[model samples]
Every structure is written in C-alpha cells, then in structure tokens.
Target: MPLDAESEAIGTLLLDRGILSPDQLLTAEDHARDWGVSLVKVLLSRRWITSDQLYEQLSYHYDLPLVDLMEHRPDDTLIRKYDPRMMNDRMTVPIKESDGVLTVATARPGPETLLYVRKTYGPRVHMVIASHFDLSWSLQRAFREQHSHEAVFALAEIDPEMSAQQVITPPQILVLYLLLSIFLLGIAFAPVPTLIVLNVLLTVFYTGNFLFKAVLVWVGGAAQESSSRAIAAEAGLLRDEDLPTYTVLVPMFREPEVLPILTQALRNLDYPLAKLDIKIVLEEGDHETIEAARSLNLEGVFEIIRVPASHPQTKPKACNFALRYSQGDFLVIFDAEDKPEPDQLKKVVAAFNQSPDNTACIQCRLNYYNARENWLTRMFTLDYSLWFDLMLPGLERLKVPIPLGGTSNHFRMDVLRELNAWDPFNVTEDADLGIRLTQKGYRVGVIDSTTFEEANVSIPNWIRQRSRWIKGYMQTFLVHSRRPIHLWRSIGPAGVFGFVFFIGGTFLSGLLNPVFWAVFAIWMIFGEDIISPYFPLPVLYLSMLNLLAGNALLIYLTMVAPFRRRWTYLAPWGVTVIGYWVLMTIASYKALSQLVFNPFYWEKTQHGLSKHTANEVAEASADVEEAKG
Candidate 1:
C-alpha cells in the first residue's frame, strides 16, 4: 500500500531535518510496511531519536502547536464524554472545550487521525501534538478510578459464577452442612461402623491421589515430545517480518531493586524489539518502583501503566487494568523476577499456530534458577519441575484443564477479553482462569519451554507465598465445584476427577498429612489395644499401605523430576521433601484461616532476597549503565 500524502510528507521532513539518516529512513520504512504500522511508530520503536525530537518534528510538519499534557491536563468531563477504549486505541484524547471548540491532544497527527477527530469530535476541534507517554499518562490519571473499578468488578459483574467474590455460595454451604450433619449423626448413632467408613474413605482418597499423580507423571513424561520438537522447528523458521505484536505485562509491587534484572532479561528475548509491547504494570501507591522505572528511561516500546490504588491490590487486578491499554494479538504475564528462555515466546507462537482454533492459552514450563541455593530452594525446584515439566503435560495429554503457572502463560487476547480476563478475587487467579477457560470451551496447551524464576530463600517468605497459592486453590475448587452438574458437563468426568485430585487434593493432602502422621504415632506409642475398636484389620492395613506407599511414590517422583534437566545433584534432596511438606502443612493452615477471615487478601511475596538474584540485580544494573554510556 502506498503511504498517504501526509505520511510521505512527515517521512520526507525527517530526512530533510536530518532527524533520521537515509539508511535509517529506508530500514524504518521497510519495517513500517512489514509491521503494518506507521513510519513514526517504526522510528520510535527503533529509538533512532527521542520521543521529544519526533513529536517536535511532528509539530513542525503539521503546523500544530505541541502541548505537554501533564502541565495542561485534559478535562475529565470532556474526556469522559467519549469512549475511553476508542480514545486509547486511536492514541488521541479531547483535552478541553472552550467557546464551542474542543482542543484535542494526539500523538499521531495524520490524515486518518484528522478525519477521525473531525468525524467524532466535530469539525471545529483544534489539534495539538503530544508525546505518546504524556498522552497515556494523562489518560491514566483521568480514568484511574473508573478503570480500577472495572478491573476489580468486571468479572464479577459479567460472569458471577466464575467470580470468587461470593467465595462459598448458598448451595455449597447447604451441601457442606448436610455432610457435617450426616457425619455427626453417624458418629452419635453407630460409632464403630462410622469410624470404619470414614477411615476407608480417607484411605481410598489417599490412594487415588497418589495414583492420579503417578498417572500424570507417566502420561506427562511423553506428552507433546514430537509436537514440541515440531513447534521448535516452526519457531526457528518463523520470519521476523511475519511476527505479530506481543504484549508482555510485568506487574510489580514494591520491588524496585530487582527491576533491572527483569528489564535485562526481557531485553534478552530473541524477538524483534519493535514488535514487543511491554508494559510495566505498577500500583499508583508504589512510588519507589515507579520512580525506578522512570530512571531507566526505557525505550518507546516499554510503557509504564500506573494502576490506580484499589482494593484487592493484586497482580491480577493490576494486569486487568493494564489489559485495557494493551494493543496486541497475544498477551502474556511475567513476574518481576522472571527470566524466561529467549525462544519461549516464539515457541508459544508456534504452539498456538499448530494448535486447534479453540486453544486460548499456551503454558510453558517453570523452574528455579537458584536450585542449589538451599534445601528449600532445591525442594521448590523439584516441585516446580514435577508440576510444570511432568504433571501439566499429563493434564494436556488427557485433555484436562491445566492450571496455569503464576507466570510465562501466554494467551490469545480475544478469548481473554471475552472471558473478562482473570478473576481479581482469586489469589491464584492464573489457576482459576485455566479451569474457567476449559469450561468456556477453550483449550489450554502446554509447551516445553521454561522460565526460570528466583526461588524463595527465606522460610517465612516461602510460607507467605505458598499460603496465598493454597488459598487460591481452595477458592478455585470451591468456585468450580459449586455447580457440580455444570462442571461435570463442561469438563467431563475425567476432568472432574483431575480437578478433585489436582486442585482439591492439593490443599486437602496438606491438611491431612499431619492428622495421618499423628494417628500413626499414636498407634505406635499406645499399641493396637487402645484404638483397635475404631481400626479394623482391613481398614488398618489399607491405611498403613496408603501411608507408606504414598510417601514413597511421591519421593520417587520428586527424585525423577530433576532427571530431565540433568540436575541429578538436586535429586538427593527429594528424600528430605518431608520437611517441605511440613512447611506446606503450616501454609495450608494459614491459607484456611485466611480463606475464612479474609479471602481476598493478597499475601505479598518479597523478591530479591536470594543471593543469586541479588548478584544478578547488581550485574543487571551495571549492564544498564554500560548500555546508557
């Protein structure tokens, strides 16, 4: 397609003024053509000149006065009159109205924008050039409250059943009451048989849990091997010009010190910088991190989205707020401490291409970079290796709903929007969204790529993070299980069983481990005579088998987890995972207490505590300085 007269004029003006060299101009033009973007965007994305210089040249070319939106803020009333989404999409905003004429601010002063402004905001509007950052910040300031409200309440209002706002519903409560009543009455009437039945049920549950996990490991081990290789080949073959724009959301809260590590990691991604739409999503109250972002003076492709201070100050809510401003065909969330493999995004793109049209998400594997740091870190790494590398693939192989990892899960923007994104009320919003996607007729695929994250070195910090995750799991199980028939119809019997063992059983096991251990200890200490009435021979034998075999199976699974990555040194640490489970039991209790008292509370996990991450942060900061110099 030929450029419009105004676009050609702007390009020519840049050359005449020596703002862009001839070779740079030619390269940018080719990129602009290939990327389906304007010459201004191509130049800006390349960082050939500062935004001020480009906007100033734009002001000169268009014979329009350049305005600083921050100094002369836009009118809230006038901005509210127009659709915010439309305004953001077009990168234009109505600044002020005076004497029947509206003064509008726009980053792009072109023919199309001129026509749109005239057609939408009346012909008497005056146009002014503003830098993209300034315009975006102004919009954020003007609509902060509205967007915040929407981010927190949109899912609840749009799909109440999927939201965790209500936590336990009326019907679920009634069912729980009925179960409790039955248990109490049975204990009151027939003690021995009731205890026997209870013992049998728990033993069966324990057996099924271990069996399900073993099955997952077996199936997941081989799942997608050929497909993953094919996807990697396709990813290698993908052309840069043909690559689509990808939005990366990095939501941070009070972790300014580690910002450089994340930024450096993102910069290392093997993708075209011009096509990366990276947003640093931060809370309005996090002044330190916000200031740190400004000090970096990142490229034009990186935008800092200042999320308004809102209740449920969660990463999901911040992501939801930033989602409104994101313009991409695909979107992904990365934590502040994440360092994904360079080809991870490309692999995700390829996976999506080969997947069914119903596929809405492609989850990548996750593990820790500081696996050898300590026992806790090693255990955490092994756990992640099992969950992401093994169990997730199993879920995919069986066509079950795969609960997403906290980060590195990519999504199709259209389906994400249609589903109202993540539920703000669910602390483990990623996991909940995965199940919700399956229920909504969308498939979630798992790829073989990995994202390395900082492992928790401190036990207290680990507990806080784990507790939040367990609480979120509880919320997901309760929310999905509310409509048993609906869930069954949506995900099928296989999925229901997976959900029970995977989601419900995760927290339940944590709570049940100590109880079983206590029972075993009592039997050993007091002998069989004290509790022989309650524990019959068959039930007692089954319980012992479940106790012994279940732990051994889990230990074997953990030992094998690190074999894929050839991190065999960490395999010996798997035997000591019993200590890790004890910590999980503590977290589970905390999670239960929080779920009962304060369900929506987000337990903030402090990062940059590990020695490895601290060293990386220092190195990253030095690299930033070198780049600047």
Candidate 2:
C-alpha cells in the first residue's frame, strides 16, 4: 500500500460516508503531499480526529467496515511457534503471547497487513504494534503529566508592565555634585588635605582592584586547565548506561519557523529517546507555533508544554512554569535557536553521575552556529566561546560561583526545584540562579558539552540582548550585595574574590573601560608634553601593565576556549573581542538607563531572518519542507 493510495482510499471512504467535510478532505490531500504517512495517522496525530471518533464517523457516514482493536486477539500458539529470525524477515508478524492473545510487532505494516489481521484473525487479535521510523509518538504522557493548567493560570497572572523602579541615582551625576560641593566647601574652609587624601585613597583602591583581578584570572586559569585534564581522563572511562534521565527544556516564542529544525536536532541527539524528556515550552497566545507543532506529529518522547501568559514575559517565567511538569531527574535548558552537539547531554549526564553529590548544576560550553553570519555575530560568538569554555570552567575549578550562560545548563531536578526554579522577577535568571545556588551551598560544575546557538547577527539586535543580560547582571549584583557581610561569610574569601573578579568585574570593567579608552585616545592625539605632568610614570606604568595583563588573559582565554571546542581557527578573534567590548560598554549604558524605566520590558531580538551562509539557508529551507510535508 503506497502512501498516496492509502491516503486517497481513506479520504474517499471518509467522504462517501460523510465523515469528513469537503474542505477537510482537501486539507488532508494537501497535508499528504509531503508527509509520507496515511491520512488516518496524520489526522490522529494532529488531534483533528481521534481513533474512536474516526471509527464512529465511518460507521455512521459511510457504512464502512470497522473493527475495534480492543475486542481482538491473535493466535497465541502460532505466534509463539514462529522463530525470531522468521519474525524479523516479515514486514508484519506475530512475535509473542500474553494470556490467550498474540503480540504482533511489525516493521512496515501496510493496510493489507491490517486487513489480513482483521479477516484472518476474526477482528479479535489482541494487539497490533506497528514499528516504523516515523510513527506518531503518543502525547498521552504530555496530557497526563504536563503542567498545562498551571502554565495557563501563570500566564494570566503575569504582569507584563512589571519593571525595575529607578532608585539608584545616576552615579556619574552624584559624583559630579559631590565633587562640586567639596570644591565650594574647600574654598571656604581651606585647611584640611581632604581632596589629596581622597585622591590617594581612590588610587590605591583602584590599583589593588586591578592587581586582585590579575591574580584571580591566573589562579582561575590554572585551576580550569587542571580540571579539564581530569574531566578528559574521567570521560574516557565513563559508560552511557550509568547516566540518568536528562530533561531538556526548550522555551519557544513565535518560533514556528525554527521548531522543525529544533525538533530535528533533538531527534539527532545520541541520548536514548525513552530516557530523554524534551519539553517544548510554548506561550499560550502562540497559536501558529502550536499548530505547527501538531503538524510535525513528532514521537511520543517529545512533549509540548503551553506556558500561560504571565506578567514579566521573561524566559525564566516560562521555564518556571515548564519546570513544574518536567519528569527527568536532571534538567537542562536550550534556547529556540540552539543546535547543541548530540553528545552534549550525555557528557553532562556522565559528569553528573560520576560526581553525583557535590555537583548541583553543570554549565555547558555555548558557541554560535552562525559565527560567520556577520561581523556582530562573529564577535559575539568569540566572546561567548571565551567566556563559557574558558572563564566559567576556570571559575568553577577554583570553587567559584560560575555565572551560567543563558542556555545549556543541566541541573539536578530536586536542587532546582528547591531553589523554586529561576527567579520570575530577574531578567538574567540564569546568572541570578547561579549566584543563588552558591548561596545555598550547592556547587555548579562545567562539562565538555558544546551548544551552538544563533548569535545576534545585527548590531541593534545584539545591543538589545546584551543590554538585557547586563541589566540582569546588575540586578544579580544588587540582590546579592544587599547583605554584603553575610555574602562574604557564606562564600568565604576566595569565593567572594571570584564573584568580584568575574561578576563584579564584568560590570565595573564595562563602566570604566570607556573612560580608560578616552584617556588613552587623548594621549595618542596630543603630544606627550600636552598630557598631565602630575600623572607620574608609576601610575602610567601600573595602568599600562593592568591593560596588558587584561589583554593577555583575554587572549589566553580565547585560545583555551576554541581549543576545547576543537575550533582553533577561531582563536584569532580575541583581537576583535576588544572592539566587541566597546559595543558591550555602549549596551551597558543603555541598559542602565532602561533598568530604572523599563526593567521588565524585554529587548526583543528578532531571529530567523539572517542572510548568512548558503548552507544555513538551504538547511533552513529543508527544515521548512520537512515541517510542511
């Protein structure tokens, strides 16, 4: 039975019986054009019609013959008499016995086999298990266990207008006002060397900060290098069976175009589908995507979780809703445009199982699939590769709280649930969660997993995404630092130093780098004589050394990251990353401004509209074809 013939026959039978409307028949024909499955299978999978409803419709409308599978039983003795070899040779054959019925599992059971079973076995055959490469995986588990009700209610309760209130006065303006007030007071009171002492103290504080950063980076790098070797050695001996269930949550929004691609990628994962619980978390209002998902008719292993419309329409909120329904022992998150390496989950699983107790989370390496899409993407990818693959692992090895990447983070379910999932209020939920985990005495480790995500290929899009991230980092900084003494006591000195160097370093560096760049530029433009004579050689030398050391660490970080990725060709992008940070500085300022005015307003970065490599376009097109078919 050819697919076209089977579909046509089914359609004709349904039409004659008045079971299907003329419009529905036409729709079925259109659906069958690309999909290599029967109309019945497609309809059933799509939830447009159910098995019981179809039978009822056929009986009433067409006077067609229908047999209930539940009432049937195959010849048990005959099934048991057949050898395994003989059973394997046939397209459809009875394999085993249970009670008085035979169990018939098939490789490619055509309608003829179904008809033969009905006629020969008197429609009483107990079970018909058709095994094919593209069977419609049942969504029974999704409906039974998924948190759709909670997600729906959550969406309704979500306040989209929720934003950060501007309480912190602009530091620049405040500093200037303080300085002016001090100058005015100085003219009147003129005796104390307050300004001189203040300047000296500021100089010392900055110098110490710079030195501390340099030392931490060195220590972090050494720790990471050693850890990598240990992981590699351990990886060699680990087996797949030892690993536990790994849940991958993919939160989607207006992502109809990318769903098929994501689906295909997940299907290609090396992990066992039965053990892998992949949750496709979608927003309630996204009907287009929901419909698109139904059409895919993916395996039973894939579940669609609808996130109710909630205020603070952030990714974390959606994740939190999905977390309620997740069934895996360990959970991981992937963004809409991610194409992680198939073995990435396995690596995390292996790492977690080997060191089960201490490790609460494993942050995988994230790079961009479309790095060469444009200058912005290329720079973005390089920066990420450096951060995740180099800096984070190093930070973790040194027993520091690693600021997690937005995606590809695997966590122990109980630990994650204990933390109440990601902060609904925090925009950069991943980073905030990482800090929170550290506070809870849980350790986050790094694995050899590589997840390739879409970089923001355009400047404006890049800015929006980066701004949100920076703003979130600022929020995390404030939330944790509110109890400074307690934070110090909790994480200890080294951990506190790591937080300052990594988390605080990001904020401070972005804020101050532009000032440093301006000074350097002014010096370059004017003659050496025109420069401030008061600025001594020691100050200049220290500043220069600080800049040099930062650059060297960056280079080493970049080199180490791509080496881990086996993408050594991209190592040269370290030089270009400095220019990228200039963009980050710009974004930081924008984020600071928006943080107070519109904290919850998500800076939307549009995707799937890139004019990158031909290969990407072709692949995307193929995905569309597969989805439609």
Candidate 3:
C-alpha cells in the first residue's frame, strides 16, 4: 500500500479536475517528501479538500480501478430464484457458491451491515471485496427512497385553530378606563385619599417586587457563573472523535435576510459534518426564506424542512413538526439571529452525561451579538446577561423551575417527546414547557455555552418584541396559576416563592415602576406638607429604603452582568438602563392590552441593521467554514 500508482494517478486527476488547487497538490507532494505522510492526510490537514470530497473524487477518477458493481452482473439463475422486489428493496450482493463457503462482494462493510448479512445468510459467508463508497451510496439511495417521509413530516404543519365563540372583553383597557373615571369623580370629592391609596399601593408593589428580584439575582448569579465554568471545563475534555451527534433546529418564518447569517453560524459549529443535523425549518408559505435556503445550495448535510401550511403560524409549531425527523439524541434550538458557540453541543452532551437522569434540559447562556449596535441593544444585552448568566442558574441551584429563553435550549430527546413537544397554542411555549417539565419531576440545568443573538435595538422594534414576551409570560402565568394547589404541589414552597418573585415580581415591577416614579415626581414638585399627613413616618421610611435599595440593586445587577461577560466597559450603561426600564413599563402596558385582544399575533422583530465591521464578517465567515467543513 506504498502510494499505489493508481492512487497517485487519481490525485493528479483531482488536480486536473480543479477539485484540488495547484498549491494543494504541491503541499501534498511536499508533505509526502518531508514527513512520509499520505497525500490525502496532507491535503486534509492543509484544509484543501474534505474527506468526503476526496473519497468521491478518487472513486470517480479511477472508476475501473475502484470496485465496479456493474461489471459483476447478477447471475440469471440467482435473479430467477430471488423476487425482484427483494432485489430492489433489500441491500444485497450476489456471491458464487464455493467449497463449503459462499464468497460475497459488497459495496460497504460495517457492523450494522455485517449484522444484517449474517442474519440473512446464517453466518456462512465470506467477503471477496468491500467498497465503503459504493455501500454508502447504495444505503443512502435506499434510505432516501424508503424513508423520505421523515423529511416530509419534518416539514409538515401541525397547527389547527378552533373557532369558539365567547364574550369579548378588554380587561386592561377597562381597568384604565375605570381608574380614569374614579380619578375624575375623586376631583368632585377631596381627591386626597385616592392619591394616598394609589401612592401606597404603587410603593408597596414596586418595593416588594424589587426586593424579590434583588434576592433572586444575588442567589442565582453565583450559581450561573459556576455552571458556566463547569460547562467550559467539560467542553475542554471532549475530543473531536468523541463528539456526539447534534441536531440544530432553527425555525424561521419570513426571515429571508437572516438566513445567510443563520446558516453561516451553523456551518461554523466545531462538530463533525456527519454528526451535524442542521435543519432549517421553514413555513410552506414563506417562499422568501425557501428561496434564500435554495440559493445557499448548502452542503448535503444542511437540509431545508418546509413546514406545510398551518392555521396558527407559530415558531413552536414549526419546531414540533421538525422534531419527528430529528435523529440526534441531543437537540439544540437556535433562533434565526443566534450565533452559538462552536462547541456548545459538546458542552451540552458533557453536562448531560455528568448530571442526574432527571436533568432533562440544559439552557445555554444568551447575549446579543450586536451589543454595541445601539443603546437599546447594549441595555438588552446587559439585561439578558444578568438573566441567563445569573438568574437562571440560581433558580436551577435552588431547585426551582427556570423559565427558558426563546432559544439555545438543549433538550433530551426522550423527555422532549414524552412532553408531546411544545404547545402550538401557547405563544411563549418555551416558558410554559419549563413549568410543565418541573411539574413532571424533570429538572432543567444551565450550561456555560453562550449564544449571541440579535437584540432589538430600535425603540419600536424593541417595544414590539418586549410586548410579545410580556404577553406570553402573562399567558404562562395564567395557565399555571389557574390552580394554586397544583402549583404549590408541583413547585413546592421554595419554587412557588421563586416563581412569584421572578415571574410575577418582574411583571408587577414593570407595571408599577412608572406609578412609583410619578408619585416621587409629584411629591418632589409639590410641598412636603401636601403629602406628609397621608404618608406616615413608618410608611415613608420603608418606601424610601425600598426605592434606594431597589435602585442600587438594579445598578449592581446591570454592572455585574458586564463583569460576568468580561466586558467591564459596559458597566457605565447601568445608569441608562433605568430609562430602558421606563420604556419596558410602556411596552408592558401595551403587552397587557394585547393579551386580551390579539393573544396569538406574533410581533415581528426586524434585524440586520447593526454596524458589524468587515473584520467581524471575516471572523464569522471563518468560523462558519470551520463548522461546515
């Protein structure tokens, strides 16, 4: 096997066919002369051609020298003996009867194939020749024909909206109207107690919520950092050879502009091509994204699963459809705008192997890739960093249910399937599913893997996205809290407290912050005597302490987030985030209104307006090429 003349001749053929560049051929020859390595290895190490490309080119170049199944035609006697259907459907190679043995010629020889052959021929078989390429092709062709339905089902739609008539009511609007009417009527009366009651309620609600948030952050932040370090350590131990199969499901709809970046990011993952199951889930009606997918002509490993036309167009619905065809034991979801760490999947696998069997989900840290895109993105990234890199891990350590981010959630296939997948009807199905998982006695852990996603930097865009998220959280709250006993039983006392502090507290704070700020402003503008009699000394002291502590905690949380990310320069923006919270309050009100009106309407967030430099693009491209190869 000392560089067979035929193989050398095939290398020359590859050069002539432009499969290997002139420089690659020269490098291959240089490596052979200098290091005594095979030209194939040299070429591979130099990143000239992929193994699959080399195999394909070599097999086709030396067509006759390579195994040729056409030359050894099946005998007419054997053909007559076996049914035509069996010959067509079953993968078999004919062998001539020999002295107490039958010598067969097969295209591929692997453990699975050998098992089948042994089962069929009673273990009295001898192999004359084995060609891996031919066997792979035959197997792929057979599988393509027989199980293409997997692909079809992966693209099918599963949403069906039921039309039910009920009395329509505008609760948020009605509440606001009632408040306005009371205020107007109070003007005719003293109007002093009304203002006092309102101030007291706002102060109590915001202060309580803020204190709860601060406590959760303090507890969760340490655990999240520790979990991240653990994940990174585990990732370091994984060899390229031991990398497990990973399925990346990116569900898209009318997002043609981001497809290029999305696919490119997936292509950059530090995983084997054979082990990567990158499925771009698209809607049947989303012709724009479909066309974008087709134009990429991405490698055979990249597949476009077209989710058939469905009633309620939702991301989880598309994911549910694709879940059926996923062959990977570990599944990770990435949003259209996400750029996940190359070894994130490996980290997930390592974490899963180390964790208990009940740990069914691993949530990866998420940050904005375009952190400096604008003031909005910067603040959004800070908030997200604190939530994922701090709050989530703390909840996990506390054994409380963790509300999942929109993407970068790695799930165990068995548990995911058992849960009947994501609820198509729930807008924030991921958040809902997190609660459901805890109820079913499954725990979710956090991994250190970070997924950089596109933050909504524009004010209007941010509002729309934030509003939808708040609305979904509201829906999740209602769905779970409809039965208080069930919630207490499933989550236990600690979890119930955690949920109220984190989810309910966040919502209440968002809704009440403006009111508190207004009271402070009014009191500052008016004389102290106007407010002093109504607001007692104890009440005033408590409110002031709460406000001071809450503001300090907000600043601390925001500043600490950047430190965790190793981007300390971003800490200055903690002052700006206060204004951002005011904006969130506005969005929360809009979201609350929409919850009763348009619960299922998806608020579209636009992207690709960030000022990414050429260097960033080149670096991203290089990452993509490495991942894809």
- Pairs that collide in candidate 1 are none
Q: Report how far off residue 57 is in candidate 1 (Å).
A: 1.4
lDDT of 2 by residue, 442-500 (tens): 88888766888777767888888888888888777766665567789878788888787
What lDDT would each prediction earn against the true structure? 0.91, 0.65, 0.69
* lDDT (Cα, tens digit) per residue for candidate 3, span 272-306: 55566677888777898889777654654466776
Report the C-alpha lDDT of model 1 over 303-324, residue by residue, as the tens digit. Answer: 9998888788888999999998
lDDT of 1 at 192: 82
Which candidate's lDDT is highest?
Answer: 1
Q: Which ten residues in a row have the lowest lDDT in candidate 2?
A: 133-142
TM-score of 1: 0.95
Cα shift from native, residue 6, model 3 (Å) = 21
lDDT for 59 (candidate 3):
47
Q: Which residue pairs does candidate 3 place in steric collision?
A: 220-394, 267-628, 268-627
> How big is the positional error of residue 315 in model 2, measured in Å on the Cα after superposition?
0.4
